[model samples]
Target: MSVGDETLRNVNLVTMTDPLLGQVVEQYRVESLIGSGAMGMVYRGVHQVIGKAVAIKVLKLDYADDPEMVQRLVREARTVNAIRHPAIVDIFGFGTLPRSEQPYIVMDLLEGDPLDSYLKDHAPMKPRDVIPMLDELLSALSAAHAVGVIHRDLKPGNVFVESKPDGQKGIKVIDFGLAKQADRAGGSVKPTNPGTLLGTPAFMAPEQVLGTKVTPSTDLYAVGGIAYQMLTNHLPHEAPSAIEVLSQKMQHDPIRPRQWQPSLDEDLDGWVMNLLSREPEKRMKDADEARRALRRIGDGKTTGAQPVSGARPAVRTATGVVPRRDWGEARTLITEESSGVHDKPADVSTDRHVSPWAATNTEHPAQVEVEEATMPPQPAPRQKFQSARIEAPTVAANPDEVLAEVKKKESQRSLAPVALPVDAPGEVPVTVPPSRAGLYLALGAAVLALLAGLAWLLSQK
Candidate 1:
């Protein structure tokens, strides 16, 4: 048998017996198994001398003989120790099991469940609740990043939530097994092999999915995903497999939080979306920036009115809003419909495309009605030709001055013979007129004829 197969066999044999229970591993006694996973098991332990509670995470037997896995466990302990933040679980000691020689890390014993479980029980948490937790989480991340430690595997399952003595929730960032110490040059101190994907797919930044270099912003992107889930109770990207989820994340931006729950604050939606940006440069610069933005959002000090650059515009569908492309073309269709320029209203029933912001939900009857009812009626078309009545200047007025004034007025009127209101609010009206009203009309007709001929020629091509 291969070494791996033999190691697996040994692990199975060891599982049949509880050898570590009540045994002293290093300076702590292994009391009970708190959890078990593919990599290892976490046990509740107490210091032999101090009697202080601690959590000991041991490497699985199959990986105990693997030097790389062993080093990774040791690296996690060193990384946490380097980042001495209160919100981060402290690792005080590292050792190996006497019988199995399995590597183990002794860290603080957190009292509460992981954030994933808390989210499941109280998802769609209010901004007030989520903001504080995020603040603490970001604070911890800021400290880690300051010390050049990047928690590459930041996800809800790695975050612990415990109630503090002050009646506030405490956030503890844990499980830095995938953490890397970045060098001064911003590259990983120990870079992974090219094309090796790290971090959880659901919360990974696009850079992580692409197997490219990761920066502090990579962790912030995961924070955005977590914030999104906390507010919406749904992952940013949901697919059957991890590969599919990664693919979706690479190709598309997550649906805006407001679309999932409109009652959410706009600034909160923007901040989360900003963090979830696919490009690292587009996301918050660091954890400090993210925390500050969160505070501003919570305080209503900033308006998130400007759409995030490079983000996919939300598509307006019959049922509800979804994230998609081709928004500009869809919006043009809405403007054309509202203008009444077409002899027959374009058959939107068969045309799936609609305005990105229009209420045209075809899937949900109730939403469609609500949107349609709230839509403002198109304004009446303005008169194209307003009589330019001119009055004779008083005889006492200088003829030269009168002539100059008349010329100025005529020039202004000729320039805007066919001014039209823009579809968007707050935009200046566009004019398509000439010097004289009659001449302007003639020019407009010629222009229209030319455009029609050009369009026909292109269609034939």
Candidate 2:
């Protein structure tokens, strides 16, 4: 009998029997069952004449009659072809079984473990390793987004870690079964029906969990989850049940990466948390932007360290300090400096110092607005004579008490003689002249008066 006839003959076989095994479909012969999932089974196949090996993913018999399921499988093949990224698995061909009418996809047979399995064996991957893997993943994602395809179900299991011949690590993003083409892309695939939750719970974005609109940022959120797992060996959200995990994802932001792995680089922690923002708009704008951000982090260029030149500077308070804006929602604040000087604003709360480089939504006042500096400003020339730096007191104090302390410090500073630097070599130090000392005392008094009046006005309010 012919190979086609043999495949047709096995259509009525019992469920326990492996019908596809050892059967020829198209130009390839099935050798063994590679793996199985809810919707399909993958088999290792070899080309009949050339002896070329490939993976054949066949739809399970249970879903053979479902047109929607069949179309979804076909769509996965089309989506992979549309995005010809090296980091994405390549689809070779798509066909159907002779009598069973089951759809199958032939694609490159990758030789590596899925990210989840690799993580199981060697997790808590170093930042150095995770960064490159994440870069490649994001590069693939950028390509998909550019083509208006969003991988609605991105997870570690779908990310394959391949071992390159040169002893370098590589990755391939697989399984576009749940991917959706954006409306503007002119794709014929119908939009997913509302109220259909389609992603892995632990990695689903808030909007995705709500079954609302899904965008490129939705995939970025899952990227954050995968990155979190790779770095800390833990999912961003963990609960007793999947439902609870979804609830937590919608209601709260994941703990910052540094909280789990204290030794993690601060730049990496910031990038990961930014990706995990509960609101889609708050996350990285697109996959390309995300990839660039990852590159910056890997290059030791910390995000939010410098301010974007054109961005609106933070609102300045009467005290010449920028007050913390209430980030009521879970979002990262990207602030910029309007003035040429790089001023380090101190938190009003006395206990802790808030780094301008990183800020998250927190209940405490220490949480400050941070800006991602896209374009670093030119460095200013060093000044010859700098004023003595005044540190904030450790204990919390009321506005009135704080003003009094500042006034006291100002008086002490004015009374102390200021040393002048000698311009020529081997020259002796010089103290501020009598006229300069008098002017300094008068200026100090004026500043103290202004501060006292401002304090009184604030109290009245």
Candidate 3:
């Protein structure tokens, strides 16, 4: 189909079923429509060569005629491929349909619901319960930031909490369709109109809504928004319309997570609010530091006690604020009050601690913890350093020096008479004459005879 025809067809595609379902696109056989949105429709597909399940996302026909839209579609795959993190969805291939103008991308077939859906059943998760998810989310953003890709849209719907074939749950950040190039300058493609909203308004940062240059911190802001949702069971900001939401995001301060979940730690709420800062400069420097902060909060030992009826933890003036590198300094103030709400048992007991790598391999978790939290947080264990071997360069020496060195060795060997060298393997042993065992015995007999004669002489006297 021509670009105009494709665009016309997709203009009315919002309520219609995808036409490509049950058809083969490249190596994938589309089975069913997994979901649909303004961008495109995702279908569960089967790869013919590998016989593995995959998720096929086809670009909307309305965007087929737009050059910037096409580039952004391809850029999403390229950005995801560049990030190359386990927490991000794995892209298999990118292509356009054989005869249709619709472009498509193939990625890992996730086997569970998006985090938003997961939250419908398990909202307001305990800090420890959601720490792994937060770790994975921040890790994905960190990897994207390292490669200069910022995920402009980071709501819970884009994050998949999948249940693997094994009985383990994994976190996968999907849909980089709204991702922006962090360092793109003249070579970048502007996919949307100026002052136009690009991401989900609820999770967008103020700079994003105001059409400013986005950095890694923009993604960090989204992470904070999602963290707020995960902890409080609601978005940091919500409204009936996109304009209102955007306006509030730009104008208003976010409600503290503790406002909804008073049992939460103040340090945790401060960190979340720091991420939701109206100014980009006020947020964490990058996702890596944000991940570290969340890990610190997660690593805190808690009593896992649910709040008693009508009881609330004492709230104090939040001090030391965010942007401080030392999480401990910011956290020390709330240590006593927040101790009871931790998701772990109050007594020393074994707790399931899954490592970052456990998502890929469910059979073997990287770590499990069995310790008491009676004391303050201890310093992280020191890492052992491995020494590397260094060899000096070899150089040729003069023949005279070699001869003198050999002679010195020979003189030293001659001076030490009893220093016999062991023979090399397969070499004949050096023969020596008799040891002086017989001579020593004869001398001893002569000494005894002389002693006997002396004794007789003494008796005669």
Indicate the TM-score of model 1: 0.65
**Among all windows of ten consecutive residues in candidate 3, which has the lowest summed lDDT?**
386-395
lDDT of 2 by residue, 57-138 (tens): 8888999989988888888889999989999988878988998988888888877777876887788899999999999999
Candidate 1: misplaced stretches above 4 Å? Answer: 1-16, 185-191, 303-313, 316-461
Q: List per-prediction Cα lDDT, in the order shown.
A: 0.65, 0.64, 0.60
Q: What is the lDDT of residue 455 in candidate 1?
A: 100
Candidate 3 deviant stretches above 4 angstroms:
1-22, 184-193, 301-461
State each candidate's clash count.
Answer: 5, 3, 0
TM-score-best of 1 and 3: 1
Candidate 1 accuracy as lDDT: 0.65
TM-score of each: 0.65, 0.64, 0.59
lDDT of 3 by residue, 1-461 (tens): 00100111123334336567768887778876656655566777887789888777777788777887788778778888888999888887888887777888777776777777677679888887787888888888777777677777777767888787887777888767677765542122343455355666677776666565667777788888888888877666544444444544553455456646766765576668778877776677777787887777677643343333432222111111121223343245345323442221111111222222111111112111222222222212112111001000111223243334445544543443232335688765553433577799999999999999999999999
Candidate 2: residue 284 lDDT (0-100): 71
Ranking by TM-score: 1, 2, 3
Report the backbone clash tally of model 1: 5
- Look at candidate 2 and tell me the lDDT of residue 78: 90
